[model samples]
Each structure stands twice: as structure tokens, then as C-alpha cells.
Target: MENASPPSILIVGLDRYGMRACVRLGLEITVVCGGRSWDDGQVAVSPEVRVLLVDDHTNPEAVLMALDRAGLTDRAFDAVYTTDENALVMVGILARHLGLPAVPPEVAVRFRDKAVQKREIRAAGLPTAGVRVVDDVHDVTGITELGFERAVLKPIAGAATRRTSVVTSVAELRACSAAYRAEGTAQRTFVLEEFINGEEWFADGVLFDGELLFCSLSRYGDPCLTAVDTARPLHYRLFDPVTEAWAYDRALPLVTAALEALGHRDGTFHMELFHDPATGALTFGECGARRGGGLTQELVHTKFNVDLAECAILVALGRRPQLDIKLRPEAVGGSHLLAGPGLLYDCPSATDVLALPGVEFVRMEWPVGGRTPQGGGTAQRVGQFMVVADSGERLQERFTAVWDWFDARVKVVPDGLKTRELRELQHVLRPEARFGDALWQ
Candidate 1:
């Protein structure tokens, strides 16, 4: 933890999950906060770790300009990284200009955009949800012929499911146009796709020069795309060794094919997927070519005894990271997003929950004086608490119990000192038939 040999690293998108992973490795990290009030999160950097806060409202060009002014450009940092899927291209362009081997900008674009993912998956003969690119409202009528009861619509350059919607009827066709227009389609791009009902999973791993190094698979307690409400709290249990063994034998190769198809040759990747139990079909959703967001970066290290962020830093610095993960370890862990039935009144007993036995860490997202978001993305997550145990199911129970305790204690308030109770709540809610964007009009 000493700064004597801190590895110099540059991280774009201060809120990206990569920070946690790198922190565990004891690297000297410099982050570009971007100065946007909303996108910025409370990132704890060591005194030895440098930070460069960008202008409150600067574009990509300004980001680079700020780095230069802050004297960071003169520093010998390992590599530049970002968790902003939308900024992959920009990150690449910036890093490459500095002669660093950033994540491929072209690959970054292809992975984050659903439209691009669908076409690439199909061309590679990999299984994936049926997707169609929508240029405008005229394309909305075609959904009626498809007759799919549910479909999902999402922005091409979105993260945290911004402006994502699911529709179940022809009458909801207007949502497509409205969603697209809201995204400014004249310049932005989006997609409509058949909503598949199934168990959702996220596979996290590091790829050094296109070779899979260390990886883990985890199951989502609720389907992110189909949940009754996007803000509902959820957890992910690391796939047991038996289950992961199956995936490594059966699914890993397919994933590699997917990586190769996207033209990604290096860096970390967090891929989201859906697997139908009935049909056993693996549908590739999308991927982020950087370290994953949410609690993944931290949980993986706690459970697997490996430092992902350190490896990323070493890779960025053009060094071979020491790989230290055993496929079989005596640990089970999961994370819970703090979701409220109504507007978040307050997260009480949060400290108590963190004090629970087996609880490892609790990271809260709420601002001391800020009101909670009504719905969508990281906004709804007031906090994320993690638990580790001897088995996956046990870990799930510990984490869920914490969420239950918070649900009962937290309240949403409208006025000073006035408190209101939350609505009916469930430990876990899954969205199945509901489509984010309706396939049939």
C-alpha cells in the first residue's frame, strides 16, 4: 500500500468500475472526473494517487486539453482506461495519440451498440436476440408483422440502460419513435429487438493481447432488461465452479469467437448474456470492452483473490501482469443494489447492514442532501453491499438479508422531517415476457 513503487495509470470516466479493481493492486491512479455533477461518483484515491478533474462541461477535446494543463501529460503513466462504453472511441483516440495501446476504438463502438452487436453475432453464426436497426418512425410498422409479444428498445451509445424501454403491444409503437427522438437519432443510433425470456448472466474477465487470462461467470437474480421496474434491487451470485466449468468448456469458446469478431485484441471485457433454460440457447446481449461497472470490479477480487485493476494497469504500461487466480477457491459472494419501493426517503440501518456478519463492504451511491432518482441505471441504486461466504447460495442469503433489512428501514420523504413508508417490496423481481422495446408493433 506504500507509494514507493506506485504504478502510474490514467483512468478516464472516474466512476468506472475499473477503479476498484486497480485500487486493490496498490497502483498510483489518476482519474479524469469530467467535472459533470451527475456522472461523477465519490472515488477514493490515495494521496499518492493523482486526480485530474476536468471542466464541468467539457467535450472530448477539452478532456485531453485539461490533462495537458494539469501536468499529467508529462507523467509516465502505465496506460489509459475508461468504463464509459460511449467514450471507448474517444478514449482510444486519446490514448493512441499519446502512443499508448488503448482499447481498439473500432471494437469499442461495435461492442457497446446493440445494432452493431447483432449484425456481428449473426455474421459469426453465434446465437443472439433478433435485432433491427431503426432509422426513424417509418420502421415502427414492421414490428406489427413480427407479432412478437415483447421487444426492447435502447440507445446505441447508452450505458446503465438510459432511455431503455420494453413494449408488449402494437399500440405502443409510438414509444419507438419517442425513444429514438429523445436520443437525438439524427446523430444518435438505437435498436429494436425481440425480447427473450431467460436467466441472465454476466461473464467478467481480462484479455491480454486477445488471450483470455482469468474469468468468472455470475448469475443475475433478476433480468435487468425485463424487471417490472429498472430501479429494483438485484444481486449476482458467482457461478459455482461446476457451473463455470460448463461455461468454460461450452461457452468460453463462443465468447472468444465473439471477441475476435468484434476486432478486440486486448484489455478487459464485461459481457452480458441471456441463456434460455428451456431451449438452452445462449443469446449474446452486449459487452463493454473495459472493466465492468457495478460491484463487479471489487467483488471479483474479494472472491477470487486476484487484482484485476493491477493487471489492467500493468497491461496499460506494456507489462505482463502477474496472474494469480485459482479456478477453485473457497468463497461465495454477491452484491445487492439498494432499491426502494417509492422515492428513496433515506437509507437507514445501512451501517447496521454493513455490520452484519459475513458482510465485506458497503458502497453507497446516495448524496448526503440529494433526492433519489425515480428510476433507471445507477441512479436508483442508493448503495451496494457485498457479502462473502463458503457457498454461492449462502452468499446470496447474506446479501439479500441485508437488502431486506434496508427495505424495511429506509423511507422516502417529501418535506422536512416528514417521512413516508415504501410500497410493497420483494427481495427479487424478474422481468421475462416484458420487452425493453417491443418487437411486434
Candidate 2:
């Protein structure tokens, strides 16, 4: 008799990255995505890959019903995969309903809600900043009672630092909270946490069967909060495994402890943390049950030669991930391109940027004449690029060179019809003077 067909997999979102994962897994894949058109050329249309269009992929029940209607309910799927943050909780719920291996809905909720995450970490005896969940603007003053002179206020389920702010006084807290509420952009619940003053870093890796398989620690050019506050472009440099012994010695154990506390299992995790230089204390910042954003995955591949997307897909299939955690000699880094508030008339061509020495790739978002949003959060970014070099210094030099070239070459027409030098454009970069704040810097 012919062998039974390979176990079918259901992918909740059909983004380019997810599509690539499906292809890598080489499974009979079914995709449930919102919208009518699949115009993006990233995902190839094939008999092996079926697409089920839905109005909303965030509704788990709707997605499951769509799966049934699409004739995938006759048998159980081997796995369900999704990388879209909006669909993560939905994927977890659907996986539970299907009796598949996935992050538990309760755990997923903690990942989505910062307040819940901090509470869980604290309860697990891990070091986390003091936090309070407030439902109204009036409740924000409680931070002072918690003995915090400065605190961070953000939506419970926000991403990329959207609507996040650092408030040093009761008035700033009240104003920030009130603005969010009045703007109708804030979630029903917001988290207020004592701001940990220190250097910020991120740990990205995969967990297989509750065991940490691979992890890479990266240092950000500036605190992410500062990036949002200053509307500056953000960058991160992956530590050279051979040279950055201190990071591994200091940060990795904390990351492992965090994962253990969070009950992480069978998925990629992106964790952010802070290291206080004065006190030598490592504090948890936040984490997500997915790969790090921007060029993180790419950096992982470039440095460690692992495919996080493929590994995540493998975990979903209940198979062991093929990961080798040896760091390469080269270093990898990337930065976002932010456009000033204006009608974008022109920018350095991706082709030209690609021609720069050590530059690897560039992805542009806004076209000519597109109105650039006032830059602050990650969402306002126009594009981003990644590079690889022999060492961190070389990487920084190349990156700065590319930035200078772009600043001189690109032109933006200001919204008020004013002419401003593109060099005078307020794209965020960490000030060089503050470079000494952290050892890695």
C-alpha cells in the first residue's frame, strides 16, 4: 500500500516569512490569511500550498471554521504555525483546540500582556521591575507609592514601543496616560513599571522540548525606550562569540532562567533585558514567544548559520530542530531608515545602497511622493538594511558610511513646503558620546 501522505500543516498567516517557513518544511500546507488578493510575489502559488482567505485571521473560531470549510477537517493537522503577532494568540488557541503541540493559551496571554508577564516572572522568583496595572489615568500615580521615581507606561499588549513613554513625574505619567486614553489608542489596561536604568540587550534563540538549543545575545545602539522617545533609528550588533565572553557569562544564564520561569516550550523566543552598570544587576525587560523583529533572524543566520523560521516550523511539527550554535568569525548588524515628516520625493535607491561596501540588503517601504509618517515607533520606519563585516568596528564604520551616503543622496519635500537639508533630518541614532555607557558599546 502507498504510504500515508505527510501530515498536513496549517499556517495561520501567509506573510513572506511564513511562506518561506512552509516551503522549508516541505509539507502539505494550508494558509488562512486575510484579504482577497495574494499579490505579493514572495509566496509561490502551488498545488502543495492552499490558501483560504478570511476577513480576519485573529479570530480563532473563524479560522478553524474556515479550515473545516476548506476541507482540512477530515483529519488532524500535524502542526499549526504563525509568526504574525496579531495571530499568535489565535494560533495558540486553535492549536489547543486541535490537540496539537503549541504554547498554552494562558502562557500566550502572558506573552501578549506585559503586566501579566512581569507578575509571572516575579512570582517565579526572577528579578523584574516593580509594575502596576492601571485601568484609568488616575491610577498611574501609584508608581510613586511603589517607590519608583521614574517609570515606563505602555499598553498591556503593545509592540515596537508604540504609545510607550518614560515618565519621571506624576504629571508626566498623568499626561501620557490621559493622552493615550483621549486619543482612543490605548488598550483597556496599561502597565506602569519602574524604569531600569542601564544598557539594553536582547537574547534571541529557540527552545526545543523545553530545552534551550541556541541563543545569541545582541546589544542595541540605544535603549529602545530612548529610541522611541528621541524618534531615532535603532540598530543592534550581535556579539562576536569569540570576543564577547562577558555577555555570555553574564546574560545567558539570566535568559535561561527567564525561559524556565515563563514555561517556554518548543518555539523561538526574543527576550529584552537590561544590565545596570553601577549595581551589576540584570533585570528583565520583556520577551515575546517569537523571533526578534527586523533583521534579527537574518543576523542569526549570518552569524550562527541557523534558520529560525525553519526551526520554529520543525518545533510545530513535533520534530527536533537542526540547530548548531557555533558562532562564525564575522559580525552582523542592521539599522532602520527613518524618513522625516514630509512627502517623500526621493531616497537613495536600494540598488545604490546595495552597492555599498559590506552592505548586504536593503528593503524600502515608501515610494516617491508617499507621505512619511512622523517617525517615532518602528511602524513609522521607511525601510531597513543589514550588513556583515569582519568585526564590530568595521560593521559600525560601514553602517555609518552608508547612513552618511543616504543622508547626502536622499531628498524629502517637507510637508509645510519648507526646504530642509536631509542631513538636518531628525532620524534617530544613538549619540556617540553615550557610547561609553555600556561595555559592549
Candidate 3:
């Protein structure tokens, strides 16, 4: 007897990690990237894998034509998956067009639209923040009618906190809206939701057959908005027994309820929620139908031994994912090295970061001389690294020690202070308002 040929998968976007997962599963892969070269030399796949270049990865028609030109239209495919948010709807449409297994296109749209998602959750009787869809900054007046002291303004379909801001006063609201308009994004519908003040956390896991199979809750060291507003280093750790127990008791049920209501029957989900330290109440933030960003998938693997990337592909292929949901004794976390407003002159070597105690891996995105933009958004972060330890306390200790070492070694020369003369100009002016409240205002 001979082995059957591996199932073929068409991944609609450039997800190097997802591609690696397909290769690991021994599946034949066809990657369609959106007008970008696949130069990420991360993982090598079988020679059987194919790459199709397309002008627009988010256009289902364009993708289908490309697939047809690549001789894929006549072939049987097990699944169509995309890690890119913009490509989710495209994947869903492609799945239906190709008769592959996937969540419906409408469901994918629900995942992409924050206003729609909040409405669905509210309709399901699940707890969610009050959200108003505004066409422009001036429309935020409706949010004031909702009688909330503060609100969060963000694009209905945006990610990574891009164009996201917190507005307390009407003036701030208008200013934030003006900035978005200046960037030519004002015409797009945005959501202004009642701000939930509390500790921010996220739950990432796989759902199988309408049941939550595996979920890990992570606590952010600082609020995501704060991290973006201040250029502060971002840190998050997967729960150990104590924190896990707390989340399971307080937050997991809410997350499960929201997913059940959203018709998220199968696939990976990354959900953000808040826990009120004052009242112990849990409120829904937002969620996506994909793995969490940054080192989230890595933390899950390091802590629970579940490879979410691989499981995502398997679930998309209509196979029951085999995951180790049992929590491990060890703890895992990651810290992103955020670059301040400047010309990034130097940073500690990956080798040096890797040599730190309990360090698992280091991924540096900024080469020396790269310009670090003048903002606190996640896009401005220079690099990140993950660490694992035997216990939660040990993990925190290592994070502190490693970051202290990093702060001492990493250097960023202010954007204008490239020479001694420019450096003198800094002292002659009021301190530049590069980030934080000043930038947002």
C-alpha cells in the first residue's frame, strides 16, 4: 500500500507562520500574497508548495482568477484560510466558491466589523460595552448622548490599535477625529464605545464543535492603549494555576458565552476583555477569528504545549484539532522592545538577549539606523522576545532583569538630534511632546 497524497490548502495571505504549519502537517500549500515578495526566509516547505502572486489579496475575484491561472481551480482543496484580517472575508468567499470548509462570509464580516460584533453579542444577551458607529469625529456627539465620561474611538475594521484613541472631553474627541480625517480615514465608519476602566486581558484558544476545547488567558502589564500612547514596552504573561483559576472563575464563562453567541463554532479565537478590579466584573472588549498577535501563539505553545498555528490550519481543513489543553507547570511571557521617537542607532544583539536566563527566543525587527517613528502604536515597536520559566514569579523576575539589561544596552538618538548642534536645540525648546497625552490631544 502507498500513502495518500497530502491534502491541499490555499492560504490567501502572507502568513509565514501559518505556511510553516501547513508544511509541518505535510499538507500541500499554495500561498497567494498581496503584491509583496515572500522574502521572509523563516521556514522552508516541501517543493510541492506553490506561490501565486496576486495584485490584491483582499479581492476574492482576483484571488480566484489567480488560483485558476495557477491550475488550482480544477484541483481539490481541503481548506482556504487567511491570517490577515482584511483577507478573512476573501477566504470565506473563496472557501464557498471552491466548496471548502469555512465559516460563512457573513460570519467573517461579523468578526471584522466591531459595531456588528458588539450588536451580535448584545443581541445574544452577553455583556458588552455600549458602542456607537460614527461616520466622522463630529458624530461622536452621539457617544456623549450615551452619557459616558470617556470613550474609545477606533476604526470598525482596524487592528493593532491603529487610529485608536481615548477621548474624555468633546475637544479631545474632535481632535482625534480630525487626526483620523487628516489621515484620510474619517469617511470610514468608526466605533466609539464606552470606556471600561480595568485591567486588560485576552483569551486565546480553539473552539471545536461549539465547545471551548483549549483557552489561555493572558494579563497585559499595561493597558494596550497606554502602551500605544506612551511607547512603553508591552508585556503579557500566560496564566499559571492561580491566575488561570481566577480567570476561569471570572472571565472564561463570559468569553465562552460571547463566542457561542457569535456562532464561532470552530476555529481559533483571540478575545480581549477587561476585569474590574473594583467590582470584579468582566466586560467584553473585542475578538478576532484568528490567533492573537505578537508572541501570543508562542506563549500558548510554551505554556500549554499547544501549537495554535498548526491547530488553526487543521481546524480549517475540517479535522478535529489535537491539542494539549492541560496547563503546564511552567510559565511563559514576552516583552516587546518599543523604540522611542528617534533614529534607532543601536540595540542589544539577539544573541545577547537569547543568553539571558530563561530566555527562549529573540526576534529583533529593527536594524541599526532604522528610523523609529514618533508614536506609540504597535507598529513602532522595534522588536520582541519570549521567555519561559519554571514558575510565575521566576518569569516576572527574569522579565525585570532582562529589560534592565536591555534598557542599558539599547540606544535611540532623538529624531532631530543627529549631531551636537541639533542636540543643543533640544535644550533651547520646551520638551518635545512626542507621545502620551500630548500626541493624543
Query: Per-candidate TM vs. native?
Result: 0.81, 0.87, 0.88
Task: Give the alpha carbon lDDT tens digit for every residue of 332-398 in model 1.
Answer: 5555456443445456545776788788777776754567655465445677777878766676678
lDDT of 3 by residue, 46-137 (tens): 56668788888889878888978987778898888877877877788888888888878898888999999999999988878898777765
Cα displacement (angstroms), candidate 3, residue 158, comes to 0.9
Candidate order, lDDT descending: 3, 2, 1
What local lDDT score does residue 347 receive in model 1, on the 0 to 100 scale?
61
Pull out the clashing pairs in model 2: 232-428, 233-428
Highest TM-score among the candidates is held by which one? 3
lDDT of each: 0.68, 0.79, 0.79
Candidate 2 residue-wise lDDT, 1-441, digit = tens: 478777688888765565676766568888888763344332456656788888788787678788788777765789888877767787888888888888888888878888889888999888889987777653465545534788887777888887778877777877776676676663667777898888998999999998989888898888887776787778888887678878888888889988888878879999999988887789999999988888887888888988888888888888888767666788889888877787777787788889989988788756777788552567677778898898788888887887778877666667653334432343322123332224653
Return whichever of 1 and 2 wins on lDDT: 2
* True-structure Cα RMSD, model 3: 6.9
Candidate 1: 10-residue stretch with minimal lDDT = 421-430
Q: Model 2: how far is 46 from its true place, Å?
A: 6.9
- lDDT of residue 269 for candidate 2: 91
